[model samples]
Target: MATRQTLIEFIGERYPEIFALALDHMQITGLAVLLAILLGVPVGIWITRNKKLARYIIGTANIFQTLPSLALFGLVIPFMGVGLKPAVFVLFLYALLPIIKNTYIGIESIDPAAIEAGRGMGMKNHEILFLVEIPLALPVIMGGIRISTVINIGTATIASLIGAGGLGDFIFKGISMYNNNYLLAGAIPTALLALGVDGLLGLFEYKITPKGLKLARS
Candidate 1:
């Protein structure tokens, strides 16, 4: 269709800008992911050791998770306003449920024998977690990261409405102008960008995973 052709033409003409926008979006996404990991992982580990805390922690995250992203954005806007900072903050919050929950579930699921062995070897709690449990549970944890990333890619689309500027810029423009070509132009590139990043991160996950702990093909 002519829409597809025009999309290609427009992207070709501004590939660098589009690519830069993608990189920026990813940077924010990465920031959110990293912040979530730092905050979530330790809490996950902590809560896994305490059932009451786990329930409370999971419940808090569930409440945050249930709020629709756009609604969350709208709610935050009065205080935070439209900008990259608010967008990044919201993405960070959205990322916590899967990342924290998976980390807890994964680590909690490690083989008891292995944990006992780790303790018998004079491994401290932290040592066992870092050396034994994390490696063993990495695949599951990575799956959470993968899911969060892909979801964030889509969620980041809403950042456009907040004027945070990603490929959503194109889509928003297209919508405002009632131009189908503009919509297709933005949508195609955003989809491709998300897919490309997802594949790359998936590869990263596999490559970083410990050999013996590599996930089995299902």
Candidate 2:
């Protein structure tokens, strides 16, 4: 049984390695979310313009979301054979649904009058979408991104199963070694990472939202 001092000592000795794994975890999560946003947001926009395509694409994203994260990683292992590539790919898929769904909802929920006003000003479809619609919808879109990113941080911990090392490496090691301290070392940092990232994104969400909308809602 590891005592308090023992746990502290373990963490102290392993600090460098733990920090590296944490960085790896963040890198993987960040890259996966970035990729999902790049791909998912555009798809969401494209589909919203076509009901049939929206149904199919959003349905597919929903299906991907339904799968277990580990199971998805397992499925990818054969093709990518473990490490950052497969882990990022699986996380990217997991991150896509929220972003895609939110983007669709955000754009669709825009006031018709606002859209018409843009049109009345002689704005083209693409111009109105870029200048007017997207600005109004940014908060909702950012909210979805926040949700996806927080989820990815937690899920990235499991990437160690495929040797895609992260804080989960400490967790699995502790589990295998039956050392509570090891588990704490991994679990605590992972929790902190999730909370920190979520808070930062929340701030971004607030900042991006139009102040006029905030006042109107208030």
Clash count per candidate: 0, 0
- TM match of model 1 to true structure: 0.92
lDDT of each: 0.83, 0.91
Candidate 2 TM-score, true structure as reference: 0.94
Instruction: Please give the distance, in angstroms, between residue 178's alpha carbon in candidate 2 and its true position after superposition.
Output: 1.0
> 6 in model 2: Cα distance from truth in Å?
4.1
**Model 2: per-residue Cα lDDT over 1-218, one tens digit each:** 45888988989999999899999999999999999999989987887888688888888989988999889999988899999999999999999999999999999999999999999999999999998888888988998899999999999988999989999999998899998888999998999999999999988777778888777767
Worst 10 residues of 1 by lDDT: 209-218
RMSD of each: 1.8, 1.7
TM-scores, in order shown?
0.92, 0.94
Scored against the true structure, residue 130 in model 2 reaches a CA lDDT of 94
Shift in Å, residue 190, candidate 2: 0.9
What is the C-alpha local distance difference test score of candidate 1? 0.83
